[model samples]
Target: MDYQSIKNILFKFEPETAHHIAATAFELASFMPPVLNALQKRYLVTSPLLEQDIFGKKFANPLGIAAGFDKNATMTKTLHALGFGYVEVGTVTPKPQTGNPLPRLFRYPRYEALQNAMGFNNDGAEIIKKRLERIYPADFPIGVNIGKNKTTPQAKALEDYRFLIENFKDLADYLVVNISSPNTPNLRDLQNEQFIKDLFIMAKDITSTPILLKIAPDMSPEQAVNLTATAVEAGADGIIATNTSIDYSLLKGAKDFGGISGKVIKDKSFAIFKEIAKELFGKTVLVSVGGIESAEEAYRRIKAGANLLQIYTAFIYGGPKLIADINKGLIEALQKDGYEHISQAVGADIR
Candidate 1:
């Protein structure tokens, strides 16, 4: 059957456990060139309008699988084969850590969202680095998202970010210094002026790869503009508008304290992108991802000043059809607006 039929069965498993089953499927497929090739034939969406040129790299499309989805860098090929133009791997730390506890991933299908306190869980950067020794030749871009270890205090967070970036910089197309996940204690504090300057200055010194700051969606528009400017001035490459939002008024009694992602964070994410875009539109690339699961959301974010975009929640709720569906919708939206190139429409509404 199709992905939806399979997902119906898989939904019975715990969210995290189900995620591994899915990841393992990709892991095995990564080794089978034929299966991967077949998947590409089945799901890949190609259109000149969807191509994006940024960071001196040309992406096949702007839609990417966000970092938390592939914490181990294991699914770049499968994601590419399934038509994602890029994949961000990890919130990997210097050392492997068992993030939070079991059942860390919770599904809110009613809201088409997920709550996770997976606290930077991964097999550590060293192991992930070895896994990619052969998986980096896919047709799309691969971005590595680095995070600090839980035991490491904020004062020493720089070492965690530096070590991982230093190790994986050359192996991937770009890198994200993720200080936004609410699950990580005091991690958001890293977004403050002094820490951002210090961590990024040290990070930029370590590699020439494009470096970005993934901020939380809970911050105000003013905070976003200030932080985006700070990162750019510190010699950073771009901004990933948001990670996961902490707002839960609608789900007030959901009993999960993890950061929220998917449909709930869309407006927050888009508004932040618009605010930052006001000043940094041409100065730095804006990677937007939050509650985006439709073509309208993607097109609107681009018009509001996003150069690239990503998704995780919608991918799960909508299944494998999500990417191609969104891409098709984006093309229709771009043409309807009388735009010849998607790039020409990047920030069409940001005046």
Candidate 2:
């Protein structure tokens, strides 16, 4: 079936149910080698020039599926088949929780953006770790994004993070400390200099997996610069430039405030990426994530100093072919700009 047709069928159900069905279907498909192979043959792009090494891991391409798409690591194998060089799974917490009330995920079809307040919902780290151990492939790079549970107090945040690190250290290619998702109350408070430094120390002592700090797009330029500098000093391997925006200006007519994602925040995401890139300046790996929908936008972020790029909202809107399309366009863009590989394009446009 075609992408749009599949999407329409999925959309016919409630949004969250559609997501669960999609993940299950993909998981089932992954078990069939022939089916998986055919899907990859049709969508995956290959290029020696596009291969990239970030924080000691090599990726076939710089494009990855951002976190929040596959929250439990249930379908990494299937996602990798669809063309993402890497698939980041989970915003998994230390304990299982139901998350916020339903209708948390809202669609704004007219604006091509989504507003979600999922509140770090997941199957929890231990369950995810066991499941990952059963399904993880040696060939693909999959990162685990860990979050504090809704019931966890801010004072004990590091304990929550430490629990996951101690348990899932070997299961993930890298570790993302997600302290920026607005859905969780006071979660972003961890972004403060002293708190982030302390958390990194705990992470460093337990796991050698490259640790990446995921920050919010709502931060001020000075705040981003300070946070990046602190993270680097504290031994962080990289920074995922954003989670989702809490700003509602993009949703001028919308009734509620949920995390805003898609084209509406692309420029803001890039600008934040550019500033963070300039501040860190070859010192840390930067993974840009908000509002990327096309190759041109991906190219812009890479040139602005993002070592790797991630997409969620765009993949939802563009369907399965998005990754291959972006990688193909990235190859052309690299050639046009006299770059040999994605790394050469990093910070090329930054002043």
Candidate 3:
């Protein structure tokens, strides 16, 4: 059967359940040589024009599967085979915690979005580190997104982040300080000045791997600037201009504490990116995440100064073919604009 039929069938199950089934199928597929080979032939898109060098590593492409999609680090190989230039894994906490009860993940097909209160439900850092060590490709760059356990007091959150950084540093190409997930209580407070400085200190001491802060789209302009300055002061390597938006105004129905993601937040996400890019202007890297699903959207973000782009909800709706389509579209857009490299287009709109 085709992917559309399969996705429809999976949608019939609870979101998390469907995710589990899909993960299992992918894991099994990764073991089959023929299937794996065929998928690579179909999905992998390579182009010198898409190459990006940052944090001392070269990316095959800018389009990637964002963090929340593979929370447990279990699907990297299949995801890599699907042609994503990179795959971010986690929101992994120091300890495994049952995320907010069932139905924590909700689909809003009407807007091609999702609201999740998954509360960092991941297989603790240690387990994920082992999983990564066992299978992560030697050269593939993996962004390890780490968070605090729900039971951990906000004051002691750094300890949890420390555990993840110290343990996963050897395996992860970069570490994403995931303090902006709206689903976790009081997590966003870490976005403030002192907390950012302190956290970056620990992150810097842990390893030389690039550290990027994931901020919420609802963060105030003042707060964004403060965090940006603090990150720059702390010698941060980059910023992923948004986690998920908590503003339910764009959404029709009500959700308790989950963060919203997808097309509805496109403009807002890019606006935040532009603000951060103002601070990052030739200094630190700016990676944009939110509401990206098409080649044009991807190019828009790039021109807006997002050196790298990521998608979770969009990836869910588009599948493997989507990655190919976006990459192809990105190349066409660059060539049509008379640009030889994607980097030349970065911040073109802002200028």
Off by over 4 Å in 3: none
Q: Give a tens-digit lDDT track for model 2, residues 1-351.
A: 889899888778887898888889988997898988998888777798889766566788888899999898878888888999899999999998788999888777777888899998899877998889987654768898999999988898889988988887888888899999989989888889998899888888887889899999998888998997898899899999888898888775654656999888888887888888988868888899999988998988888888888999888878779889999999999999988877788888774
What lDDT is reached at residue 93 by model 1? 89
lDDT of each: 0.85, 0.86, 0.85
Q: Candidate 3: give the clashing pairs.
A: none
Q: Model 2 residue 320 lDDT?
A: 72
Can you write out model 3's per-residue Cα lDDT over 1-351, one digit (the tens) per residue? Answer: 656788899889888898899999888886777887788789978799998887777788998788988888888878877888888989889888888877788989889989888888888877888898887554557888889999999888888888888888888788889888988889887888888899898789878988888888997777787788788789688898888898999788848669889998988888888888877767888899889989999998889888899988887777888888999999999999999999999889876
Off by over 4 Å in 2: none
TM-score of 3: 0.97
Over 4 Å off, model 1: none
User: Against the hidden true structure, what lDDT does model 1 obtain?
Assistant: 0.85
Would you list the clashing residue pairs of candidate 2? Answer: none
- Per-model TM-score, in order, reads 0.97, 0.97, 0.97
